[model samples]
Target: MNYEHVREVDPAVADALEGEVQRQNDTLAMIASENHVSEAVLEAQGSALTNKYAEGYPGERYYAGCEYADEVEELAIERAKELWGAEHVNVQPHSGTQANQGVYYAMLEPGDKILSLDLNHGGHLSHGHPANFTGQLYEVEQYEVDAETGYIDYDDLRDHAEAFEPDIIVSGYSAYPREVDFEAIQAAADAVDAYHLADIAHITGLVAAGVHANPVGTADFVTGSTHKTIRAGRGGIIMCDEAYADDIDPAVFPGGQGGPLMHNIAGKAVGFKEALEPQFEAYAEQTIENAKALGDQLQERGFSLVSGGTDNHLVLVDLRESHPDTTGKDAEEALEDVGVVLNANTVPGETRSPFNPSGIRAGTPALTTRGFDEGACREVADIIADVIDDYDDADVKAEAAERVQNLTDAHPLYE
Candidate 1:
């Protein structure tokens, strides 16, 4: 928080911050899980609140001199609850994965059955990948996308629910492009008397702005990242019915974590206030529109988009059909060479390893925040396709890089 002293002590860290700002100003950020927070949010994140250590919830702190910290946290909690229409909200979880873990801690015992979507089929790691704590501590049964349609198969999910008899059912993803059917997922959970949890980390902004359907009223627990689409600081939030507030709070505090980051909570308050503004609705709508436009443009250029297209802000490009000889890893590096940033992801039923998957994931939230619309999205798609088409050609890559620089310069991110 005290960058002046930091500069006096070590100029390297100060130089790193300046370099990061320059990098953000120069590059095109297309990663779905990333976004630019408002200056107000950043200010709150780097405020004097960082000096305090409020170790407990409001009206109940273990440390002294927490009155102001309690006020800031209470504002964040109230704003979050109001913004999401949640009965109860906890703004303490450090990340989305930790929020999911808190939900599990509140409800399920060790080795209890958990039904979640497969990671390769758009699910997140906390949804029970074997390498994650969720899978190691619980019995995990995974459902997958429909092979033909590349969408969730409700029948298959129901069948798995009946067979697995899970204690918890998770509905969410990191790379999925289509909107999830939360009502149907809730029904499936109810059919087996399982607790339904929805991780809306990627679409929290859309949900906040009412562009996407709300899952808070349907799911027993909902977890989200304040940073991604919400455009907040790097922290996680959990919302649930008031009846479960006590269990969830304790689960996050004593069960999973200790002292909360009051600085991040202050930033969360500012972000929630921004989301409640009328312009945030327009921003969310434009994000989806830009994504669809980009997807359409890519498809017109003969690129194979997984799930056909997107109903959200992200599109998953299946490189196998577009560039049969090139892996997504190659496409990712090729695009990055041209200043376009995106991640290589695994498509459903992908034969490639996770380390070097066969799909590229891109989104429009950060670009949209930077004032990009349908036309800019189309141009970006063209640049990305051009780079992929010339993956092996150094001359072509150089030309593409120059064009990318022009586009990025024309549309500065922060200015």
Candidate 2:
């Protein structure tokens, strides 16, 4: 795990890298999009494959000596297929955003309509945020969760899809904490004759472990990031029925990117192999249990959860109702000072700037990776409430910092 070679060549970079490792070890990583990969995955991602330019798919290449690269890529594709149960899988997209781009390229013209969840309502930037390329290139409309219930209003989505008559309907989310009903969304897309793109970027590992319902067989296209719940180093994947294989392959390759990052694909392969073992299922189950426990503890302390609770890895806490005087950023900065890390996110019907939104999003994947269970997460919830309640008090922060240290010491990262 030590970067001795890097130290000899670039001590400055090595210092920063080692500093990051120490930071992760010391702090609580509750950020919903992150997870700590295994040391085997770390070694695979840092392997010599990084230097190879594997520009094409397995058994097909634009350069010489791609035999070994092909082998690695093939294993990643096969394992992904087994994990997600898609007839066709493309492991080449550089990210989940690029994976979405591949699907759009294959399915729509520049002006075609897209219907997706609203960004402030737990959707992703790549889905159709005005600042993102997808929003700029396509005519976009959005749906939202119920204002009172904090759950996706599937009926509204279905009605909106009919009115929009979009080229595609995007499901899945970034901040919403409930399990998705992919079948319901699929029915809506079918009625509108639109393609269904399920961006399960945050729940990839949950679906693989059978804790979350899979979108592969139901959605027309499924895209996800390998590093979130899955603990694969970092990359994106796309799955589809064999019917659209040709359209997708070209769209991802010459359509969006050039050479693939073989090392990242190798990390995905190793992580997927690790996930196939029996123990991974328990890990996935515990992640949800921890989230429920964390949210329950927060509720008992008077924090307002967006969905009342969660059925998945993360929970969205609306600071407006719980601590009206304190902004999400205020809590975020104070928590960081106490060595607790998470993100301030926009909640439904948000009134503040996205830079400093109304809610904080927390998750259990990273903590669970470090061996945290329900009891540890409940303790963390109390620490979070303490900071939010008295963010300016040094005594409170010091006490909370001590608690965070105790938790981190108990369930150490990268140990």
Please report how far candidate 2 places residue 392 from its true position, in Å.
0.4
lDDT of 1 by residue, 118-176 (tens): 99889999999999999899999999999778899988899899999999999978988
Question: Judged by lDDT, which candidate is best?
Answer: 2
Residue 101 displacement (Å), model 1:
0.7
TM-score of 1: 0.98
Q: Which stretches of candidate 2 lie over 4 Å from their true place?
A: none
TM-score for each prediction? 0.98, 0.99
Name the top TM-score candidate: 2
**Tens-digit lDDT track for model 2 on 1-415?**
5999999999999999999999999999999999999999999999999999989889889999999999999999999999999999999998999999999999999999999999999999999888999999999999999999999989999999988899999999999999999999999999999999999999999999999999999999999999999989699999999999999999999999999999999999999999999999999999999999999999999999998999999999999988988888888899999999999999999999999999999999999999999999999999999999999899999999999999888887776
Instruction: Tell me the whole-model lDDT of each prediction, alpha carbons only.
Output: 0.91, 0.95
